[model samples]
Target: MRNYFIDLLTKEAESNNKIMLMVGDLGFSVVENFKEKYPKQFINAGVAEQNMTGMAAGLASEKFHVFTYSIANFNTFRCSEQIRNDIDYHNYNVTVVSVGGGLSYGALGYSHHAIQDYALMRSFPNMTIYAPGTRSEITNCMKQIFKSKSPAYLRLGKTLPKNFKKLYKPNHCAPGKWTKILECKNPDSRKCILTTGAVIDDAVQMQKKEEFSNYHIYSLPIWGMQYKTLQAKQINKWDEIVTLEDHLEDGGFGSYILECNSNIKTAGETKIKLKSLNKNVCNTVGDQDNLKEHFKFAH
Candidate 1:
């Protein structure tokens, strides 16, 4: 996912001179391509995440589309104030790029876990949450991010499978929209699995079980506070909606979805289920797969 981000940014920077990238003294081997290609547009902030975020905001104020990159926790929790005041508050065109989201850096311990990142970022009124579930979603999300001049949080895993089943029918994505991955043939089928970020893989695997054959699968790669109003209409169409995410249950994708439909009368009767990582996983130390097993999210 990090490689895809850099490659896409490098390509986009060729024509978009406003595109600038800053790092918190990380992304050594992976970011070199962009650094070498566009030296003037790249900067190493030397471990100062707060300052890096502020710098990105300053650059955005100057009409540059800046991207601040670092490990998930460093780029978010460590510099949240700057992100809120400097970038999100002012509606700057700065994308906070967080690599190793969720427990991707589990081997490094709880300090690096990004399980609560969505809880933090979504609170910002102007922030767009881009949690791509597939390689194609990553590409589509980046394209949309570049085209819009708004504050965004791009959460990425440390590594991703080289190939997977293509979920999006047209292989494209849009903000506040859910792409149909697998469609149910039964017209009466109303239960479906909706996911954001890499958990889409788990949802896909779950759909193959005999008990879940009637369930369809969908992935929502981009969404946030501004897009909440769009949810009620979609939710109205389903009798049962199961949301999955790598983050904790509280304030995660499922919570956000429920919040969106909280006021609707029919929402009371709709079966809304949430499948997220157990908070207990926070104390464990292992790779992503190991952590998933600990949380019982692995299939």
Candidate 2:
């Protein structure tokens, strides 16, 4: 996913001189091609994430679409104040690019875990969350981000999921709009698993199980606080909806869906189920797969 982001950004930068990438002393091997080709468009902000965000905001003020890149938490939680005050508050054209979303960096311990990122990012009214579950989704997400010209967050995973298939033509992503992946064989089936971010692979695997064999698979890669009305309308279409995410229940994708339907009168009939990582996973750390197995996607 990181490779796709850099490659897409590189291609976009060829003609768009206003597009810039700033790193917090990270992305050494992954970002070299962009830096080597467009030296003026890249900035190494050292270890200071706050300064990096502020500088990116300043650049955006001058009509540049700046992307601040770093590991999940460092580019987010560590400098959240700056993100809120400098970029989000002002609606700057700065996209906070975070790699290793969810537990991709579980081996490094809790400090690197990005389980609560959605919680923090969604709190900002102007922020749009872009979490691509597959490589193809990344391209469409970049297109929307460039068009938005406002505060955005690009959450990426360290690697692709096993047995992942590429899409020939991905549709443009929009907040609260779902992109269908696998259709259920049963024509009568109205149940589906909706997911965001890297946990999408888990949703696909879950659908194959006998208990959920008739469920369709869909992903909402772009969403934010402003799309509640749109989400509520979509939720009412299905009889049963299962939301999956690697983050904890509170302030995560599932919680966001529930919040969207809470005030809707017609959405009460739809059953909303949540499958998210157990808080217990925060206590144990080995690697990404091991931690996922320990939690077993707590219901």
Q: Which lDDT tens digits does candidate 2 get at residues 249-280?
A: 89999999899878688767889999888898
The per-residue C-alpha lDDT of model 2 at residue 77 equals 96
Best-matching candidate per lDDT: 2
lDDT of 1 by residue, 79-123 (tens): 999999999989999999999988888899999888999999999
- C-alpha lDDT values of all predictions: 0.87, 0.88
Compare the candidates by TM-score and give the number of the best one. Answer: 2
- Model 1's TM-score against the true structure: 0.95
lDDT of 1 at 194: 90
The TM-score values for the models, in the order shown, are 0.95, 0.96
Pairs that collide in candidate 1 are: none
Q: Provide the clashing-pair count of each candidate structure.
A: 0, 0
